[model samples]
Target: MEYQYPFSYDWTTQEIIDVIKFFEAVETVYEKGMNRDEFMTFYRRFKEIVPSKAEEKKYCNEFADSSGYSPYHVVKKMKESNPGDFVKMES
Candidate 1:
């Protein structure tokens, strides 16, 4: 909440919103919990906006540094979980 979401100046308004939603979903995993399907939906949109793995790592690392939530870990859990399962993170 104290830090802004990492984004690109070239992105469209909707793309920026979608990226924020994706970060919010990551935050939700640490704060409460998010369903795997819902998280994946946002994540898919995020990947569409930032298709590069290096860029994804940069943004995710920035967010994690500011918020203490790791998008990578949540995503790893999502990949390991079945659909409808809730993803949550502690740390």
Candidate 2:
């Protein structure tokens, strides 16, 4: 939890905040549960900020390494679930 979220200096302040928010949602998925649509909104914004697959993977890997929470798994679960469902992951 003390780990810093991965971010690029090239991003604006708001972009950094949005990226942090997305990572927080990923944490929420592991810590408790998050609404599918809500988490998706954060993820959509994250994707907008990090459009490159390689870059996204890098950040995701960094976050996973630090927090032991896998954003990739959370996103995959959300994608595989039905609309209006709550997404939860094993911590």
Cα lDDT computed for each candidate against the true fold: 0.94, 0.95
Residues 21-70 of candidate 2 have per-residue lDDT tens digits of: 99999999988999999999999999999999999999999999999999
Q: Cα-based RMSD of the predictions, in order?
A: 0.8, 0.6
- On lDDT, the leading prediction is 2
Model 2 residue 38 lDDT? Answer: 95
Question: 1-91, model 1: which lDDT tens digit per residue?
Answer: 6888999999999999999999999989989999999999999999999999999999999999998899999999999999999878886
- Backbone clash numbers for all candidates listed: 0, 0
Candidate 2 vs. true structure, TM-score = 0.98
Model 1, which residues run further than 4 Å from truth? none
Top candidate when judged by TM-score against the true structure = 2
* TM-score of each candidate structure, all chains considered together: 0.96, 0.98
Query: Which runs of model 2 end up more than 4 angstroms from their true locations?
Result: none
